[model samples]
Target: MQRGKPLPQKEVAQRMEVSERWYRNLESNAGAPLTPEALIRLSTALALGPDERLALYRHVHANTKLGEPEPDGPEEARSALTHLLATHERYPAYIVDHAWNMLDCTDPMADWFPWVREPEANLLRWALTAPEAREQLTDWPRHAALYLAQLRFALVSSRDNRQLGALLDEVLADPECRRLWDEETKVVAYRQGHRFRLRLPHVSAREITVTSQVLLPAHRQELRYVLLLPESDPAPLPNRGERDPAQCRS
Candidate 1:
C-alpha cells in the first residue's frame, strides 16, 4: 500500500493468506531475508507504489547502498530522471530542471509523440516543432506560449548559472522559439490549483490539473513538482461505433 493508506498490514495479510503478525514483520523489516516468492506476495498484497516496492526490494535483497547523492551533472541527472520516468509507468511524468529543460519521460508520453522511443527528446522541441504534438494539444499556441514564458522566468531568475544560460541560448536559436521570444510578454507564475484540458492520443480529451509544489535549498536551483492529474475517472473509449464518435472526439 501507499505510505498513508490505512490498515495496510491487515490488507496484506488477507491478500497473502498469512497471519497479520507475519505480514507486519515483513513490512517492519523484522524478517531478515524475504524469500523471492514472499517478496512478490508482499508487493502484490501491499499494492505498493513503484518507489515503495523498490525500496522494499533493495532493503531485503540488493544490499545496495541507500540513497545515492543527488545527481550533480547532466549525465547523472539524466540517469536519475530516467529511473523516475520508468518507475511512474501508469502516469505520464516528465522532469525539467530549474530552467525548464525537458530531461526524460515515460512510454505513455508516446501518446503525444510519434517519436516516443527517441533518445534525448526535449519537450520544447516537441511542443514547437512536432506536428503530431501540435495536433494533440487542444490549445497549442497558448500552451506553447505559457511554457516559453515559464522558461523565460526561470532563465531570468537563474541568469548567473552557466548551464542554464547555455540552455536558454540553445532554445532561443530556434526560429519558432525566436519568434515567440520577441513578443513582449509578461510572465505570471501559474496560480496554484489551476487545471486545464489536454488531448492525449487514443484517449478522449481529458482535463488535467497542474499543481506547483516546490522543493528547495538544493543549491542554486529550486525544483518544482508538476503533477498531471486526471480531472475525473476517464471513461474507456468504445472500440468502434458503439458510441458517438463525434462526442468521443471532443
Candidate 2:
C-alpha cells in the first residue's frame, strides 16, 4: 500500500477538496458511500494504481445497501474511451462494456476481426462461437475457456443484468461453448496483462503474439480499453546441452 507520500489526513482531504472529518470518516468506512466522481478524486489523491482503484470500487460497491440501485450500463462508448481506441491506431485496440460487448474499435482492429461492426457485437460470443476465431487464434481452446470463465465471473457480479444473461444463453447455445463453460471452473475478473498468440495471415505469414493490456477510464470504469501490444520475434532457444548460467546454482 505505497501511497504516493506520507501526507497528513488533513492534507489528503484538502487535495481531494473535502473536509478533514469527512475524509477521516471515509478512511474508517463510517461515512456515506462516496459517489463515482468523489471516488475518482480520492484515487487520484492517493495515487492508486489500476488494480487498487478497481479494488476500491469493488469494495465500495459491495458494501452498498440493498436498496441502492446499481449504475445502468452506458448506451454508447464514452468519448474518452472512443478517443483512446482511436489514438492506439497502430495496434489493435477496442472498447468493451462490462458485459463484454464491443462498443467501439480501431480501424485496424475492425480490419483484423471484422465482427466488431456487426450489430450487438460481443467479444466473448465471437471468440466462443465463430468458426473463424479458431483459425485466427493460435490457442483457441485456452482462449475460449478463458472467455467462458470471464463470462461466468461477470454473470455472478451482474446476476440481474438482462443483457449479460442473454449473452450467456446465446453462447451456451453452441455445443462446444456449452461444454467448455460447464467444464472450465476457473474464473477471471480481469485481463490486465494477458498474453496470447494470434495467427493473422493478412498481416504476417507467421503467427503474432500480443499482450492484452486493460485500461479503465476515470469516469467510466464499466468500459474497458483493451490494447493488444505486439511482441517482437522471440530469440531462438539454445541447444539442449548448453545450460544457461542463470539456471545454475552458485
Candidate 3:
C-alpha cells in the first residue's frame, strides 16, 4: 500500500507496467515471488529510497529465504546509499557489500581512510592487510577477530559462489586474515557491534566508535553500512567563530 500522498494502486500499476489487479495482488502479498526484474520495476514505481527499498526487499526475502546470492547491489540501491553517505560532512562513512567491497564513501572518509578510495577496495581485506591499519586501529586483535567472524558468516551463503569464493580466497591468502579466520570460530551476529580507535596521519589522536549496520535487499542481505562516530564531541576552541585577520586580506 502507498504509505502517503496521492499514489494509488492504479497509478502505481501504470508506473510498474502491471495491471491494476496484479498490483493490488502484490500490495496484498497474495501473488507469487516477484522476479529480480519485477523487483527493480516495482522499486522504481514505488519511488523507494535506499532504506525503504531495502526494507521492501527484506519483506519479500523473508518468505523466499536465501534463493540466490546477490553479488552486488542494484543501481537503485547504490544511488540510495550514495545519497545517504553524501550527507555526512564531518564524520567518516561508507557502504560495503556483504563481501566487504567498498561501494562508495563520503569525501571525509577519503581523508580519514585513504585506502577506502582505491578501486575495488574491500573493508575486511584492507583492515587486515594494510600496513597503515596497524597505526590507525589501536585495538586490532578484537576488531580483526570480529571482522573474520563476519566474513565467515558471509562465506556460509557463498561456499559455491564464484565471485565471493574468489574474494574469500584472496583474503584467506593474507597472513593476518588467515590467522584470524582459523582462530575466530564464533559467528558475530549482525546486531552485536564493536568499537575501535583510529589516529589519522598528521591529525590528533581521536577515539572513534565504529559499528557495522546492514541494509538488506529482498534478493539477499548483502550491503553493510559502516559509520565512524566520535566517542565524544570535541571541546570548543577559543575564538571559534572569529576569522583570522590575516585571512581577511583576500
Name the best candidate (by lDDT).
Answer: 2
- Candidate 1 residue 30 C-alpha distance from true site, Å: 64
Worst 10 residues of 2 by lDDT: 241-250
lDDT of each: 0.55, 0.74, 0.64
Error of 2 at 204 (Å): 1.5
Each model's TM-score, in the order given? 0.48, 0.64, 0.59
Per-residue lDDT tens digits for candidate 3, residues 126-216, read 8777777777787777767766665655555344557667877877888877887776455443533455566654344345455544555
Clashing residue pairs in candidate 3, if any?
Answer: 57-218
Candidate 3: segments with Cα more than 4 A from true spot? 1-73, 206-220, 233-250
Better of 1 and 2 by lDDT: 2
Query: Candidate 3 — worst ten consecutive residues by lDDT sum?
Result: 241-250
For candidate 1, write residues 1-250 as lDDT tens digits.
2344365668768998788888777667686346778888877776664444544564454333436465566555445546655665655555555655454555444443435345555555666666776666667777767667655555444446786576667767777677877773434343235455666536653544333332222432344333455556555556724432111000
Winning model by TM-score: 2
| Candidate 2 lDDT over residue span 124-237, tens digit each | 888988898999988898998878867766665555679989888998999988889777555567887899988866556577888999887654566888898889743333
Model 2 residue 222 CA deviation (Å) reads: 1.5
lDDT of 2: 0.74
